[model samples]
Target: MTTNTQNLSGQSILAGAATTGNGRAVHGYNPATNEPLEPAYSLIDLDQLKIATAAAAEAFESFRSLEPAKHADFLDAIAENIEAVGAELAARAMAETGLPEARLTGERGRTTGQLRLFAKVIRQGDQHGVRVDPALPDRAPLPRVDIRQRKIAVGPVAVFGASNFPLAFSTAGGDTASALAAGCPVIFKAHNAHPGTSEIVGRAISKAVADFGLHPGVFSLVYGPGATIGQALVADPVIKAVGFTGSRSGGTALMATAAARPEPIPVYAEMSSINPVIFFAGALSEDPAAQAKAYLGSVSGSSGQLCTAPGLVFVPTGAGGDAFAQAISSQAPNTAGQTMLTEGIYNSWIQGVEALGGQPGVELLGRGTEGAGQNAPAPAIYSSSVEQLLENPVLQDEIFGAASLVIRYDSAAELVTALSKLEGQLTATLQLTDADHETAAAVLPTLETKVGRILVNGWPTGVEVGHAMVHGGPFPATSDPQTTSVGTLAIERFLRPVAYQNFPNALLPRPIAKDNPWNLTRRIDGTLTTTGE
Candidate 1:
């Protein structure tokens, strides 16, 4: 439970075994100081990587059929092991990613809480998705044969760690938790920016696997070049599905590799999104200065490295809008930037901001003071017209930092037209009151198709992890809009339905068997029924 740099192997944990690779070694760097941390991690070759995938395939047979109690227990144990790491985990993550200790501590709790949530989901057994259609021996035209169905694990899954969230969206994050809950073996590709943090959490999961007496292949943590090993992992025939959280370019590249395989597989990749916020006249009439502060806080928080950060704001051109803009101009100059995840990310953010600022109609609204750190850059907000935003594609691209664009619109019709031109987004917000209901209703349909989640009178920076919450959207927001990367529904991404026709009770899966051994809720003849119902 007590982990430190001295005990860190900086090696790939393959099938519960510590492995050292001969390929190039990489070190985790402290972004706040721009210095490398101790214990360089060795990169694994493609052949070495195969060992993990092959073991995962071998483990799937037994793992996919685990008893509900044991399966739920395994997930619960993982949560406990991660929680036991405690302060050590937070300290290591802070050193690697330049995130504050308080933030990392809360993220670690969120990570464990989600694992435990999945444990509850496993015990309930509803995810089995069982259904039965009784045979009809006598019918006017013909007899109907017996048919039954239930969802099953797809197979081994490849998960890529995220850069922004070292704990909540990395190692044992939502993607890995949901895949494991669906009974799929996982081969996790650690993010190079936070190798040490990955190692600490990877060991926790490995310990849980050992404690449960499950196949060591149930989980494996790997390190390597993203271009070489990352794409190769998706291309591996043994891997049946993939879970990714990163850039649009990275997600599209993996989608291509997955499609090219002899047996194509699904890649549930969370990619780019510039979450937009719209301000109606009435909502801005009440204390525009306070509203502006709240808006800027969401934009600049976590250095705007969040996937759900509000990158675009729509304000009407009038007195209320003028008041809001004046408040932003007054407060934005004082906002400070925090250290970013990596040097490459910092450099890319700078380039994006410069390119956006150079656009034909874009003008700098305000700039904040730079924070005291190696990679910290000043936060910036730009302004543009609806006409320019609709005409120029560059104005819509996500800067991926503490930068946002404020677009001025002349009328409701113009606002809707400008919104229609936007790409798919993870979220959209409306600042409205009773007077704005008509305007809000007019735009609801378009927003339904454009975003996964809609917020009213609130910013989109915080995402709730629960059964009903969706962290995905159409097209560019994620590779598969039907699936979410967070919440219980995410388990479906790694599962597929299989039908059994005219099969004897003895040969049927437990969930759909005649005896009803698993005690699952099932749909029979289009009616929801449980045991004794």
Candidate 2:
């Protein structure tokens, strides 16, 4: 491929999407002190967005052809470089976002871990695929058609940085890492909320770019607040996929914009979820104290900031609702009111608490209490009958803060009906004792229908990067139902498989070579066999 020596202006990194009026840098400040966190690129225009995205789009053509092993090396390099700056990144996140030190450090580790996990998966270039068939050698004269599934890259990608996870979901976060591993070039639109941190991560990635002598356009970071910046990136003809994690309105607006494009691209935007936990009579009958302790920790961790935190708990009629509420309330009072991502976040969480108590059938079980600190308190609890919860959309939506609702169910039938009406969520929890395992088994199918993951008795936060992790859910939980936000499968969002039916052996991928270069699993002559089955 011919190369163009284009000017690489570091300035593009500072300017927000061009729509923010005349070109200028947007300097984000601390909401409390009203002091600048650091210098950041102001709103960028449509033209700049095009320039950045176009470069990444072109880079994909070359990057995709490299051997998977070499690809893995570059990916590992990116992770290492980011890990090197883990401390600095975390510090800046705390200073800028008003997040506590401990939380940011944990998030930094998660970010790097996610990068390495995808690196390990695609480094072998064995995009997980399997061929299944009943041995047809003796099945008859006519043979059965074999089925093979493989993952491949879709194309250039656009990732929007999120406010809550400045490090994990920012410029070098899960979305960017997975896309790059899948052989897709990435154009990241820095979140207006954290451009400085985004640049810091961007710089770390740039170091990897130089170290690997990578195709420069493989990574592009631009800044802008106005929807125009995001609009241009998602609508561009060259951008084929997008990854987003944010509020319902923000993600939905972007999704609509992506669809309105002349050629719609896949938008894997994880919107919001309430992540409900159901506790049956057997749960309380088994160990009410233990369940209470567990729920308190799950909902209160991260100040209930985690997307998968159990926001609603369903208790059987007279099944220790008071005990559970008291347990959770006791723990809530001790949690120091930490600052949320912004004043808007602090305010939103409080409103969710009020909206519940404001409802007719609802009663405040525990008013959200706060420990005086930098940010407002978020702990809020309310009680409602199963019918009240099932009928109200407001009660079902995620409060997005440290708030959980305790709903009392009269019977199994009522419990089933309430769950059936839930919105798709990243995870759903079941707190049951060993003796109630039979009951859990019976309801597993119902819970699995609307969530990406079902947890037996684990808190959904602290996502583990593995083959089984599915951080995305149905419909509004995520824009793409088939793609996941975690795990090796997350790479599928950036890939699309193409078949080579009866192609000349010489034209096959090297992984499928006479002597496999990467030594990957392959389907031969319609059989679950080796290179030459």
Candidate 3:
């Protein structure tokens, strides 16, 4: 445990084997010490891309035909393999990302939990969306023909590893789990910031594929700079869909690339969000100190690197509001600074703070404890007027660090106006009391239009992985608001409906056959049941 015992092949994985490509070289880094880790990773070459994607296309034919139980077993095997890595995985991730062992351990659990949840979802047999309409020869005019419909996999997908949550959002993460559950193979691109961590997780997935005796092409992990292999994977004709989590520019660029292809595909990219939190007068007056403490904690956690961090907080302007601001100013300085995940991110956070502080009418309330590490960033709190935020669109952009912008408003109407000026967000939280029902009701519509999830007297930092969770939003928050990047529902994004007309029972998919071999719930002649009759 003292030495880094994690296996670092530093090679891209293709068709279940560790490989070295003929592209640019990349190395992982220890953000805490600003030192590079061992085992360099080579980018997947154009020839390798063709090989990996072709294998994926070849594997799809059999993978899509595998029974739901087999798919569930495969997913479960993957989770078990990941858990087998244990502390080695946590240690490597902590060193690479500068995240605490506890944080990485929790993220590891979330990753495995998501895979297991998708296993249960596939076992339920409802993802197929079976519908059958029997022919009615007794009808007047021409006889109606029998028709059936069911969902099918959308072919292979390209998944880009995220920089923040190396384990939960990278190789073998939610996108990969959901895609594999929907019967599509995945080609993962390792993030440069955490290549060592990606390699370890990728090895687990490769081992699971071998253990389950599934096709080797069912999963592959590629490495390189984001611009090189990333574009090649998306443009590969074999890849039918994409899953990404990164900056707005990066997401939009990928979307544009996918759109320009001869056969365009869906790109579910979670880009950016300045998840806003609104504070009601009653909640603040009830316990200002408690509210202030909670706010500081949420914004400062993980160096404020989370996508759902409360970047913007709305408060009422008055003596009570002044007291709340003063309380935050007093506590923020005491919150210790933490090392960021990457040097580039730390630089960006510094520049962002400068921009906000230099803006007209924006006042810096306080700064947190500073650290000596080159990649460390101190927490900061700032206050501004509603008019200033409305006039400066830049204020709405996320800082991607431990900083929160407080906008004080004189009236509820002003709060609504400020809300209207904001863009789409991943979440919107409202701190309200039972007596503030009317005001809560008034702001609900604005919140609904602006965010994917609405919170009642809750913080937006921690996202639950379940059946009802939505880790996505409109436009800037994600490319497609209709879909989410978390939970069992994410499987639907990689599936498409297919219908059969007048096909023989033997020719139809088992789930949609008139004989009902699979015993799945289906709409038969407009009635929902397990039996076709």
The top-ranked prediction according to TM-score is: 1
The order by descending TM-score is 1, 3, 2
Task: Tell me how candidate 2 scores on lDDT.
Answer: 0.72
| Better model by lDDT: candidate 1 vs candidate 2 | 1
TM-score of 2: 0.89
**What do the candidate models score in CA lDDT, each in turn?**
0.91, 0.72, 0.88
Q: What does candidate 1's lDDT look like per residue over 1-533, in tens digits?
A: 23344478989989889899779999999999989998899999999999999999999999999999999999888888888778788888999998998888888888998998998888888778888888888965999888998899999999999999999889999999999999999999999999989999999899888888889999999999989999999999999999999999999999999999999999999999999999999988889999899988999899999999999999999999999998999999889989999989999999999999999999998788888888899999999999999889998898898999999998889999998999999999999999999999998988999999999999999888899999999989999888889899999899999999999887888889877877778898788887521
lDDT of 3 by residue, 320-435 (tens): 78888989988888888889999899999999999988889999987889766768878989989999999998888889989989999888888888898788999999998887
Top lDDT: which candidate number? 1
Q: How many clashes would you count in candidate 2?
A: 20
Model 2, 205-283: lDDT tens per residue? 7667666777778887777664777877888889998999888888888888889999998898988988888886666
Could you report the Cα RMSD, in angstroms, for every candidate shown? 1.2, 4.6, 2.1
| TM-score of candidate 3 against the unseen true structure | 0.97
Q: Give the poorly placed runs of model 3, Cα more than 4 Å off.
A: 1-6, 140-142
